[model samples]
Target: MEDRKVIIETGWNLDNSYANLPKLFFSKQVPTPVDSPKLIILNDHLAAYLGLNVQSLQKSDGVAVLAGNQIPKGALPIAQAYAGHQFGHFTMLGDGRALLLGEQITPRGDRVDIQLKGSGRTPYSRGGDGKAALGPMLREYIISEAMYALGIPTTRSLAVVTTGESVFREAELPGAVLTRVAASHLRVGTFQYAAEWGTVEELRALADYALKRHFLDGDGTENRYLFLLQEVIKRQAALIAKWQQVGFIHGVMNTDNVTISGETIDYGPCAFMDTYDPATVFSSIDMKGRYAYGNQPYIAGWNLVRFAETLLPLIDDNKEKAAQLAESAIGEFMQLYHSNWLSGMRTKLGIFNEEAEDKILIENLLSIMHKYGADYTNTFRALTFDDFTDMALFDTESFAEWHEKWQERLGRQEESKDSYHELMKSSNPEIIPRNHRVEEALEAAEKKGDYSVMEKLLDVLSNPYAHSNEQAGYVALPEKSTCPYRTFCGT
Candidate 1:
């Protein structure tokens, strides 16, 4: 294959840090050029945030770069090597259909990975064709942005590009690519791979790189590996707590999907909970409910334990001492997760001060929600807007009793009603990327080539913290369906 050399000029201030690491960490590769590359959507706001030239990115040459038809200047394209525990089964995995172009130095002096998903295959592709369907690419764009607006830590999608090709996935579907920006692509699985395969020096090099990139605030000079473990655990704990607060179901909590930076990645089969059921599972492959809504925290803790194992050799010279240190760190996860969840829940319930009964009050509301099959986001939004009187779940006797207790609890707060309302309004989002609605948008764009529906949905989701008249339609749950709603991976 020849380099197209399309000469894209999108103000790329690329710093290929990950590529500077040892060759054992990655395999260099070039993205396969497509026949007719086209830009479907370019996130102008994100482009500006990264100091990119939006006009250039919207041009044909830039489209070529985004669609993997061309590689930008100074871009060191590679498919990272790592291993992961998929459903508790260990296996080697990498960016099969993705390519890390390079890390862009943002205008704010922050470094972020600029990767292209669905960007053809490399050594890691295995037996699969490295192509992505249009619908799933758009699904990621919509949902990742929605999560960003809702204040969750997640990788942001910069743009979606059409390959002007077809991918045979269940059917012949239009092919596409997604530009994903993240703090960094280092994952817990990367550590696992280093520990299981690489030499000790290689493992330390990986840890040192991670510390420099993400955990520099900590005193990492003496026991940097342990510091890395503690920091990652803290971040994952807080991130999962935030997910639980908003009814987010990651669907697949694989170790590879757990970002070392603690940002949410891999939106495949992921969805927001429509009804407040702890047992809710939406991923088509999750037959056992392993990654159910309620199990996210536990899964996160479990994944961190795997990460801790990787660092055992680096944490201390004595294996027994390292095991004890790692155990203590992992043991503190649930407590950290509990505190983060409770703090967020308190803000949602408009509680400013701490109380011993706060956890009980929060759980009681969840229990009532579970009993009534109430919508998760709407229930919180109802409380935010003080419009719960007409909701079917609120009309129940259990809710009536709970409502009285909630009111009494609010009365006990030192904060004024206005302050409480403000907190609740900010904490509760009026919009989430609802599964059915996301399906609707994807279908419209994929089958009909009409992006108006998706554009409208994006507009409504952009300001999740504020109230708007246009939110009524999007805020509404889908009409009841007999079949269970399921989500599929982009692969």
Candidate 2:
């Protein structure tokens, strides 16, 4: 390993707005270090974007910085407070296993938070170890990078450093901390935390700050806060639609996991589908399927309602008036989500116009896919290549019938075949972070200390829509026997 030291200049104009609130809002502390720190994965591209020296970061000093063994100058580590409704039940929660070191303004004028996940326990650890296992750390690194490459708004992994130690979960697993960068870590649950504690003033302050930072157009108006709420709803609707279009199941859609900035925050128990079953779920803790593939839109709407309720007191002085205002904002979520979803589906099917029967044709195709168990990513990917010959993948002839109907729908469009084909290829991806591939990579890293698998997967996923004979295996769906790989929380 290299021995160069990383020079970090963290002039974090601490903007400690939430922290300036009552002491009860958050716990002031520093991160606890792991037994031994080892560099596992380094996101050199992100480091360069943040103006950090990539060559220096691949050294022992880099390992120390990422492993929480040393807090860089000007860094303030603190755990944020929040409340969440996990799996349909409301509860108080916080950054139980994560710490927000501080925020850095990038060279591009974007404010990004640098946080240490799996840093040892804080007051909010809730009697559990605040550390993360290696498997989950690797999982987040793989999937989040893939999401970024797919053009989804998401938190990007800056680095993954392994603690040369083991943590006990079902068994002893290697420990790790993921350096995550995001626009902000503020979530809907942060508002709920204020409301639950009866800190109405802090709630209002949070709303105002969030508006200025994220929804600047809604500033200085009488109904600015309400307008901000509406803006968040719109962004969230579009984000969830994007998720559905790609067959992503968030596994855990708790309000705490919903970022106010509309970027996908937590990667816990999340998975991309192999088969086209809308009811698919791979989160080991999600036994009830509340956040299944098909249920994401509805669940996102529900979470937005929770957010609206938290903001009700700040929206208006009159309780009834506040309730009405919040309700109206919440109601718009479904319409916005559906509009984006339908438009994306049309592109996937190569339809440009709003034909009256477009929806029915799309619905029937999904119905056929659900019945026959077609591979979600592969099915759409094959359509882009004009290869509908692999009908056996769907397990029935009904899929072929639906394919004919799909072709008929495409024929109604005015674009030429080549143009339509190019459009489809652009809209559909030839690569996704398949669960089996992720698992295989993790196994190699843990057992053989090899990172070749991870490096190859990242290269392929970075341009998911491109065709490459060298990456043909990556485009194929995992075998049926490997179809139901389960993901864990890595707590």
Candidate 3:
């Protein structure tokens, strides 16, 4: 592919800090140029965070750079090497369709990696096309931003650009590139690569790099590898707890998809539950209920075990001692996860102080919700309503009994009714990027070439806790589809 070059713009600074690590950690690869580049959506809020000027990013030269048609100066592009347990099966996989365009230093002295998802193939292409469809790219942009707004740690989308080319998927689809900004692209799988393929020295170097970038306090620890494992455990535990509180199913909990930074990555085949079924599995690829709604915490711990294994050679020369230490750390995951989950549930129920019976109160409500097939988001939101007299809902008698107990419990607390109302509203979002709504947006874009639906959906999701009369329809549950709700990886 010939390079149609353009003069580089100003105020762009790229730092190849990760490149200082051993070359075995990553392979150099430039983004394959696209046919015609056009800007689709640029996240101005995220651009400012990276010290990028939105006005400059809208220019023709900027679009070229964003679409992976032109590589900016000082950018050391590389396709990272990693191995992940895809669906519980270990496989060697790298950046099959992405390129890390080095790290960008923000004005606040913070470091963030700017990577191109859908950038062309390299040594890790593995016989797959290194292109992305516009729908999936937009799906990521929308959902990542929504996650950010919901106060979850996540990789943010900086921009999305159309390549003006067609890619073969279920059929031919328009190609696009998503500019992904993350704290760092380092995953547990990166360490897995060093452990299995590279030398122990390489593994130690990768651990040191991760410590400096993500866990700085680990630098002073006598056993940084153990400390690093502990830190990752803490983050993953809290992260999964938050996911459970919000009714989010990652749909895929592969080791490679889990991030050491604790931020949620890889939005593929992810969705919030419409009905409160703990066994709900949305990802089309998750044939087994392995990564279902109820299995996130267990799967997170399972992924961390893989990560802990990668560090065993570094923890201590005594493999048994290392294994014992790792097991102890892994044990803490469930304890921390349950603590966080309980606290979140308490807040959702407007309980500021602890009560011995709080767990039963929360679980009883969930049990009734499950028995009735209640809409998860709406069910929580309905708790804020002053009137709960609806009789037509499933398991109404059970829910009413539970509600009476909940009110009696709340009466014991010192909070005023208004205070409780405010807390419930803040804790429970009135809306989520519902599965049907997401499909509607994608269908509008793919079949009709209309992006207004996406734009409107993003607006509604931006302030999910706030009530908007015009956007009330977004809060309603979708009519049951003839086919079951299923999400795809779009790879």
Candidate 4:
């Protein structure tokens, strides 16, 4: 094979808009390299989408480029600065363990930020090593790819590289780096950074840039800041609704994790629930369950309010007017979230219309699921194939009664029963990244150098709605012994 290592030039012209701001607004620095970098995972499809040659990227030379041992040409690496409310408490944070390796404008005219996770520490490291553990890297790869397959907006993983080093969390774990591609990495916390530092000009500049990049239609509006806030609210509402529909809990809804681009950005300590429960929390750090399964919508609204506060200065010079405008924008979050969430719930239940009793039917089914500790994904998946004969899966006679009512509701719809069945089949996935299955795959990979299990799980997750007779075991929930397999923050 020809030499795959290619040196690209650093396109280092500052987008003066951000750099022109005061120095306190950001600390400019490049990514620090690791020793003995080796490629662990490569996402060829994503590379080709970005106009990169996949064949070259699969070679050892491309491994070095992705591992940050050698910087790619036209890449200018810098750690972004931002502040966030971590678990409901405001705290200053930045790209402590990651570096943004500049932006790539795809052939399709989409601007995607290429970032290196687990690169050596920067000013924002905060007394900790900036290394990432291999387990978390694989977990993110699995879950992020699953999210993408499910048709949700998210920051996609481009590649994963193992550092010939170990990180100490509970034990010595292998280190890895994940190349993450995002629509934009700007977060609500980015604005908070400027607002806290009293840099109004920088805040306005950041808002204007975000508006141009994500909400182009808001240009020249009298209340442009208000328009931006409303736009973000709409996107976030839809994003979180999808999370709920898929039984995915982010486990960390911190302000820093809330991207202005509205993509599911950070995949830390996130998991898909095996059984439905509103109080589900898998993050070891989330002891209080602040970002629990049921609280996601409320938490999203709370985060948007913080984003609104940062934009108050630009909303209007009058503080009172700004607060009023911001409040109006924030108020819309709940309604918009409900609209999307309810729509998704209806689809899950095979309900095609928005009826008054639809909410009651959905809530009652959930109540039964929680009461019986029934598997969330499987229960919904079974409903798609149900001919009203598998009452035992509902786990209670009471639920069986509710199923009859659901069947009656379906009878009222004008569409053919086959069409409703197909709709539910598509909306309710046959497989999800079950906690036990993911843990099982990770254990095998870490202990035996075997990735076969992970590969199998990925194959099943890719076609989540497809019925595969050979892979029936993949859709089954874990037994009682594996019921509480919680995920950890692979720090």
- Top candidate on lDDT is 1
- After superposing candidate 4 on the true structure, give the runs of residues whose Cα lies further than 4 Å from its correct spot: 1-25, 387-395
Q: Candidate 2: misplaced stretches above 4 Å?
A: 1-22, 393-397
The residue-by-residue lDDT of candidate 3 on 1-491, one tens digit each, is 99995553545789999999999989999899999998978888788878887888899878888998888878999999999999999989999999999899888999999999998888888999988999889999988988887778899999999999998998999999999999998998888888999999999999999999999998789899999999999999999998999899988889889999999999989999988899999999898899999999999999999999999999999999999999999889999999999999998888889988899899998998888778887788778765443323433678778888999999999999899888888888877888888889988987898889988998899888886775678876777778778888877
Ranked by lDDT, the better of candidates 1 and 3 is 1
Q: Candidate 1 — which pairs collide?
A: none
Candidate 4 lDDT over 222-266, as tens digits, reads 788889988899999999999999999999889998988889988
Ranking by TM-score: 1, 3, 2, 4
Off by over 4 Å in 3: 1-10, 387-395
Alpha carbon lDDT of each predicted model: 0.92, 0.84, 0.88, 0.82
Give RMSD (Å) of candidate 1 vs. truth.
3.4
lDDT digits (tens) for residues 1-491 of candidate 1: 98785554589889899987888899999998888888889999999999899988998878888988888888999999999999999999988999999999988999999999998988989888988999888998999999999989999999999988899979999999999999999999999999988999999999989999999876636677888999999999999999999999999899999999989999889999998999999999999999999999999999999999999999999999999999999999999999999999999999999999999999999999898888999999998887976468978889889889999999998899999999998999888888888899999999899999999999999998877788877888888999999998879
lDDT of 4 at 47: 79
Worst 10 residues of 3 by lDDT: 386-395
Point out the worst 10-residue segment of candidate 1 by lDDT.
Answer: 217-226
Task: Write the candidate numbers in order of decreasing lDDT.
Answer: 1, 3, 2, 4
- The clash number for model 2 is 0
Model 2 weakest 10-residue run by lDDT: 9-18
The window of 10 residues in a row where model 4 has the poorest summed lDDT is: 9-18
- Put down candidate 2 lDDT per residue, 34-137, tens digits, no spaces: 77898888887888788666766666766787888887655778898889999989999998888887776667777678899999898899999899988788
